[model samples]
Target chain A: MTTIDSPPPPTLRADSLQAIGVEDMGVRYDLRFTKKTTIRRSVGQILGRGSQEPFWALRHVSLRVVHGESLAVIGPNGAGKSTLLQVLAGIIRPSEGAVDVRGHVSGLLTLGAGFDRELSGRDNILLGGAFLGLEDEVTRRLLPSIIEYAELGDFIDAPIKTYSSGMRARLGFAIATSVDPDILLLDEVLATGDANFRAKSKARVIEIVRAAKAVVLVTHDMSWVTEYSNRAVLIEKGRLIMEGDPAEVVALHRQHTDEARAASAAAATAAGLDPGIAGQGRR
Target chain B: MSVTSEVPAAFRNAADDPGAARLIREGLADIVSRRRLVRYLVQADMRKRGADTILGNFWWVLDPLLQMLVYVIFVTIVVSRKTPDYPLFIFAAILPWKWFTTSVVDATSAVASQDRLIKQIQFPKLVLPVATTTAGVVGFAFGLIPLAGLMLFYADRISPFLLLVPLIAVVQYVFTLAFSILLAAGNVFFRDLGNVARHVLRLWWFLSPGLYSLAVLDEVHVVQANPILKVIANANPFAILFEAYRKVIYGAPTSPPGLPDWTSLAVLLLVSVGFLALSTVVFKRLEPSFAKVL
Candidate 1:
């Protein structure tokens, strides 16, 4: 057989008392190999072994979710919304702090994360199932319902690349929700697909959200934050800024955005720049 | 029913660098527990490689046969070497060499290429290299059909020592696996590694006994006079492995098919297992950063 890090060690463990727990968690990313600066700094390093700057994608964030709870995380772009979900999903181990998660976690963290575009939906389903460490037979038993939910019909046999973006999202949602794990983590996915598909999926999401012991959703849609979650937390600049009723959290996030825009607009006006353009800049 | 990490902050970060014992336990445990993922990934890999092609699986059979012929013509006509049953002799080295090169090359990018998958899901990153390397075994298995045909065609070269093929392969597997883990993790931190690996592997093939066995190397004064070069030549695992393949497949120009060098095989096994443990430690140490870097 072939053979196959880190310390604070981000500590994410499982405890029976809580569905998920994070204590002083943080994830630092190296700027050199990051998507934006990767090319420039990588070349710089090759030319003259330069020191790499580390960006704290998340910092001093602690959160907890208990069984029978649904928590929504909302934030603007690059606010580490997905990063928080990634930590909860155990895809990322924090550089600092500890986390405990109680049971099996299944998620469609990113719409296209686990899919192989060249494989048929059938193959990708099995592939995704295998990613969750399920055997072929166990995945096969769940196939019919996944297909029905995805509504791929004959397209289930076609390569995933040929499926519309909506179909892809549907298939992803189906797989994540199908396994009935104790906890479900979803990332910016509920807003996908056509209206009819969305309507049908809302019911499925509700069913899953209610059935699973705990559910964590990351989305930009304010409506979804309130409509889907009983408890919500707002994230901004990698910090948990607020946590409360979903509607109140969503409202506060909106107020903060508007205030940020107004402040930027005022600064623009004082500097003889266009307020409209400046308002858009911060977002 | 409630609990909190009682570990002090200083000690909490201790997990950042696991002890050797824990690293070994986790490394072995991850590979063992998630074997189904490896099998599935290997199947998916083979399916993708052969998809939508007219010849499909036939290419696996045809590829080595065609390469053997090319090498045979190059050796006999271009180099003017006269060797009988050259096809079987060369074919033996070709199969295992191909497996080693292809698996290692694949492992170099295995984890790096799954950047999105790694970031979005949680599982042992160990599975990535394990899966890619095991897929090579399947590809190598496909190459065996040609090996069988060559043996049957040259019935005179057949020997009971051929049963030792799997035994020899086991050694090669252990060695390739150790290197694959190292390469897989190293390539993530240094993107240039994959590019360098291709050229290095090609040079390695040339330096190994693929084209000429140790029997020939012993005849060279440059290699014989320099004890360091002589030891390096013997230390090349492929030197021992390729020579073993040749021994069981047909043997040197003067000798008949026979058992491989067991002493060498055993040494390779122990060294490879040690290297595998070391590679696993390195791989795991770098793993948490993979989702970050990639």
Candidate 2:
């Protein structure tokens, strides 16, 4: 597996990355339970207190990415990986800190994120391009290339609802990369589609990283981390646990997962339940 | 790739401390830059709304025509018809009223309905409400074709002032757009507002001079005696617009006083512009909370 050494300082990194940066960003969400009666809640809120509880989705996380850098974020579910990506994409507002993105940002948090299912693929391309802030004429000019890259052919005119899952992924990936944004945020988008499409998408992503300013990828695929990303960060329970070389971070994550599994198994055995049965229930 | 050393203004402004004026300025700038997105969204909505039906876009014109037919039948059988050219009279008011009611109602839920798009994409939040209003205008424009046919049948009633119809339509559009932006932004926080607006709009329709002309009210001595009621009756933007359409289309003289009251038109314009400015400020203030609430 390919591994990168420690990254250079921010000034030196800026020379390679262009001008992308993230500084001390944090996001918080209030967990509201509407169990109280409306009148009672209103009265309480008016009195300067309410039942809503607050929790941080991401807390005091800081990272600097420059041009040509692909930073991989790996964590277990609910580790705030997706939240961080959403915050970077400007979809979510941070509660405690600031994020400064230098240029145009394209995000693929989910397949066909803003696509209208009733619209044909051709129309969706126009709509999606517009959402990315591309003018209509520019989208028109990019149409042939998007279709060619997606490999949808005759299906491009069909409504998106009729397309297979893989086809939707291909179309989304094609349109997102077509714009060549200065900053790209991907949340497991590279893991979609069949092997052939995956290879093509990977190649396209490589081109984007080489050509564009910066990229932040959130994925559990360790192979992708080692091979593609120059830096990796492991976060757990909304806290940044470690950051450095991809291989080092992956090794730390594996050790942490094993320890957690062993501790859970021991707790189950102590309670007179088979660990295997506990694992089966989870599966 | 060569990169600029200076941070872009977008990044230099701290997210936490962006003042209200700054937010409004940035939001407006963002919307202006993404104006093509608004147009595309409007077109996509206009097409997708009725694509599955046999009538398709025919419904845009058909829906208002059917409403006008119901009012015509009611006026002919039940109500006292003081106005000549009754069908043309109802057409003038109903066409613009349909635009106002539908645009306001559709826009009320525009933000909440696009939960996925708002949560995933980073485009201006104002686009959703603005696009919905524009889509309503497209339907209203189609509804005008039949009105034009009715206008031709009453060719003698047409006036030189008919050139003012487009100006009146622009005023009404601004009025509808302001209400739409206000309601769309409010409904994000209070989902019940959408349901409330439907019933409220039904009452509002009757309050306007849509079904019956102001001439009927002018004949009532009781309506004229109450100064408060008279002022309210005149102050309504819908009444002002419908009256403007009647004056321009039917060459009808202004009621209560025969002379044209340009003050009403000026008042309507002022209210529409002032309301638009107010709603934009409110929308920008509420925008950052939308994703979390949704």
Candidate 2 backbone collisions, by pair: A17-A66, A17-A67
Candidate 1 residue lDDT tens string, A56-157 = 888888887777678889987899988888777777777888777767777767665689888899989888887876656778988999999888899999
Report per-prediction Cα RMSD to one decimal. Answer: 7.0, 4.4
Question: In candidate 2, how many Å is residue A164 off?
Answer: 2.4
Relative to the true interface, what fraction of contacts does candidate 2 keep? 0.40
How many steric clashes does model 2 contain? 2
Native A-B contact fraction in model 1? 0.33
**Winner by TM-score:** 1
Q: What is the DockQ of the complex in model 2? A: 0.37
lDDT of 1 by residue, B1-294 (tens): 111111111122314667777998988888877777787788888888888899997888888889889889999889987777888878888999989988999999898899888888777889989998999998888999989988888887778988888889898898999999999988877787887899999999889888676777788899778868978999999999999888998877767898788999999999999999899998988888788878
In candidate 1 the C-alpha lDDT for residue B7 amounts to: 15
- Sort candidate 2 into its docking category: acceptable
Determine which window of 10 residues in candidate 2 chain B has minimal summed lDDT. B1-10
User: Which runs of model 2 end up more than 4 angstroms from their true locations?
Assistant: A1-18, A32-50, A262-283, B1-9, B12-15, B80-82, B218-226, B251-260
Supply every candidate's count of residue pairs whose N, Cα or C atoms clash at under 3 angstroms: 11, 2
